[model samples]
Structure formats: C-alpha cells, structure tokens
Target: MSELLQFVFSGITVGAVYALVALGFTIIFNASGVVNFAQGEFVMLGGMITVFAHAAGLPLPLAALIAIVVTAAVGVALNRLAIEPARGAPVVSLIIITIGASIFIRGASQLIFDKQIHSFPAFSGDDPIHVLGATILMQSLWVIGGALAVFAGLWLFFTKTLLGRAVLATSNNRMAAQLVGINTKFVMTLSFALSAAIGAFGGVLVTPITLTAYDVGLALALKGFAAAMLGGMGNPKGALVGGLLLGLLEALTAGYLSSQYKDAAAFVIILAVLFFMPQGLFGRKSTDRV
Candidate 1:
C-alpha cells in the first residue's frame, strides 16, 4: 500500500506539470485551430530565465514573474511574426511552422543558456511531508495546488468573463465571431500569450523537482500532446484529466514494471485515444453534413 501511495504521489506531481503543458496546447488549438508545437519552449524559457535571473541576484518570485511575462511576449511575437502571416495557409503548413519554431527556439536556447542542466531551489524547503506512510516533497504540494488553481482560474475565466466569452466565441466560429465584432485576431494573440504564460508558470513551479535543459522541451511537448489527445483536444477539462491520467500511468509503470517503458506510456495513450476514444473524455463527437 505504501508503495502504491508513493507511486500515486510521484504520478500526481509529474502529472501536474503535464497538465499545465496540456492546457497550453488546448488554448492554442482552440483559438487558432492550429497546434503550437513550440508550447514547451515556453516552459523551458520560464525555468531557464528564472534560474539565470535568480542567479543574477533577483528574488525568485520576481524572476518567475519576469519569465512568465517574457515568455508571453515571445508567444505574442510568434503569433505576429509567423502564425499571422500564414494565417490562411493549410493547417499542415501551420503545424510545420510551429514545429520549425520549436526547433529554432530550442537551438536559440542552447546557444544562449549553454548546454547544462539547471534547477532552482524549491519554493518551500527540501523537506518531505508524510501522508499515509508515503513521503512527498513540499514542492509537490505546490505543483498540485498550482495546477488546481490554474484550472479553477481558467474555468472561471471561460465561464464568467466577457473576454473569456469572446475567446470562446472565436473558438466556436472565427468567422461568426468576427461578424459579431469580436476581435478574433486579438483573441488568437491573447490565447497564445495566455498559453505561454501558463506554460512558463508551470516550468517555474516544477523546475526544482525536475531539473531542466534546453532540449527538455521536445519530450515535454510530446508528452503534453499525448495528454491533450487523451483528454480530448480543445477541451480544458479533458486536458487536465488526460494529463493526470497519463502521469499516473507513467508512475505506476515505472514503479511496478520498468522505468524504461514509462515514457512509452504516452505514446500508447496517444495511439489508444486515436483508435478508440478520439473524442476524449470530455470531448464531444463532431459530424459535418454536406
């Protein structure tokens, strides 16, 4: 039982990170109808920027804030410089653009930050809290709490705020949203910025636990994509559920089976979602009639 609880704890911590990444994916996909593969780079930027800033004598909180803001600006720039110019292009082309952007960002980061793994001190101390005989890091609690708080914030934003409704309307139908005087372009830009900010925040929160490097974004992007697919793309609720579920599966596999196969769980989940549950847990089936 203790072993099982340990696995669960590990899974939830990792899952919270994946959940943040997945939410980023969801926001971009919903707003632009294009997946931003560079999403994970935002996470990398968050951690890397904070690490350097903190090292440069800035407080951790301020450093994190700067990272999030800078990442959001980068996201806005991505939209303006790349996505906007190719707005009417084929979806495949947009996806390829995002992939290229990811590679470009990764290379830039490697050059700027050097090829070294880095981490920051945990927000709390290094102490572990024991719950039901399973020890968990205090930072793990922060991560879980962060995920829930973000989820709640997003839920309220979508369900209550006027800007949120505009974003939703744009996501529902871009042409109609524009006709209704909703600034679809602004909505897309906002989506990217918000997504990037969220990803960066996750990176800041999780970096102490998971040391980061420039190349880490690729794996994170892949896993996040898997989680998004599992929960149903475009559904925030689905993103959260899928991320946690994927994390749990990975932890259990690593614990009971072999750590070697744990990463493969994301690939398997993606395949399973594609073949059987393509719509995902909270996603609705769609049909078009000619």
Candidate 2:
C-alpha cells in the first residue's frame, strides 16, 4: 500500500507538469488550429534559463520570471515568424514547420545551455511530507499548486475576461470574430504567449525535482501531446483530466505491474482510448458538413 501511494504521489507530480504542457497545446490549437510542437521548448527554455540565471547569481524567483517572460516572447515570435508565414499552408506543411521549429529550438538550447542536466534548489527545502504512508517532496506541492493555479486562472480568463472572450470568439469562428472587429492576429499571438507562459511556469516549478536538459523537451512534448489528445483536442478541461489520468495510469503501472513498461503505459492507454472513443474522453463529436 505504501508503495502504491508512493507511485501515486510521484505520478501526480509528473502529471501536473503534463497538464501544464497539455494546456499550452490546447491554447495554440484552439486559437490557430496548429499543433505547436515547439510547445515543449518553452519548458526546456524555462528550466535551462532558470538554471543559468540562478547560477549567474540571480534569485530563483527573479530567474524564473525572466525565463517565463523570455519564453513567452519566443512563443510570440514563433507565431509571427514561422506559423504566420506558413498560414494557409497544408496541414502537413504546418506540421513540418512546427516540428522544424522544435528541432531548431532544441539545437539552439544545446548550443546556448550546454547538454548537461541541471537543477536548482527547490522553493521549499527537501523535506519529505508523509501522507497515507506516502512520502512526497515539498517541491511536488509547488508543481501541483502551480498547475491548479494556472488552470483556475485560465478558466477565469476564458470565462470572464474580454480579451479571453476575444480568443474564444476567434477560436469559434475566425471570420466572425474578425467581422466583429476582433484582431484575430493579436488573438493568435496572445494564445501563444499564454500557452508558453504556462509551459515555462511548469518548467520552473518542476525543474528542481525533474532536473532538465536540452533533450528532455522531446519526451515531454510527446507525452504532453498525448495527454492533450487523450483528453480532447482543444479542450482545457480535457487537458486537465487527460494529464491526471495519464499520470495515474503510469503510476499504477509502475507500482503494480512492470516498472520497465511504465513509460509505455501512457502511449498504450492513448492507443486504447483512440481505438474506442476516437474523439477522446471529453472531446466533442464532430461530423463533416457535406
């Protein structure tokens, strides 16, 4: 039972990170209908920049602020430079462009940050708190808290803010929003920035526990993309549920089954869900309008 609880705790931590990443994906997908593969680079940049900044004598909070802001800017730039240029391109072209952007970012990170795995001190000390026979790092609380806060913030933004409503309007119908005087281009840029900020924030919160390197983004991207798909493409609620479910599934696999295949659990469940539901747990059913 202790072992199970331990796995559950670990899974929730990792899942929170995944949730953040998935939320990032949903934002971009909804606003632009493009899957920004570079989404994970925001996380990588967050961790890498924070480590270097902290090493250079900046306080952790300040370093994290810089990382988040810079990453969000990069996301805006990506939309302007790459995605915007390729607007109206084929889906395959768009996919390739985003994938290329991801590769470019990874290569750049390696050059700028070195290939070393890096981490910094957790916000709270390394004390482990026990609950229900499971010991969890204080850092895990940060990750979970950060995820919940971001989700709540996003919920409020979409449901309450005029700018967020503009985003939603753009997502529902770009032409209609544009007709109503909404600046669709600005909405796209905002989506990218918001998504990247969320991803970077996750990176900042989790890096102390996960440690990070340039190459880690690919795996994170894959898992986050899977989680987004599992929940329902373009659905914020789906992203949250999908991330938690994927994480819990991985934990159970590690604890009760084979640790070696624990990583496979996410992909396997993704396939299973796709096989049956296709649209995903919370995804709306769609039909082509002939």
Q: What would the TM-scores of all predictions be?
A: 0.98, 0.98
lDDT of 2 by residue, 1-290 (tens): 88888988999999999989999999999999998888888999999999999999999999999999999999999999999998999999999998999999999999988989999999999999989888999999999999999999999999999999999999999999999999999999999999999999999999999999998888788889889989998899999999988888888898889999988987887788889988888999987768
C-alpha lDDT of residue 61 in model 1: 98
What is the alpha-carbon lDDT of model 1 when measured against the actual structure?
A: 0.94
lDDT of each: 0.94, 0.92
Ten consecutive residues with minimal summed lDDT in candidate 1? 280-289
Taking the tens digit of each residue's C-alpha lDDT, what string does model 1 give over 1-290?
Answer: 99999999999999999999999999999998889899889999999999999999999999999999999999999999999999889989999999999999999999998899999999999999998999999999999999999999999999999999999999999999999999888999999999999999999999999999999998999999999999999999999999999999999999999999999999999998899988988889988869
Instruction: Give candidate 2's error at residue 275 in angstroms.
Output: 1.1
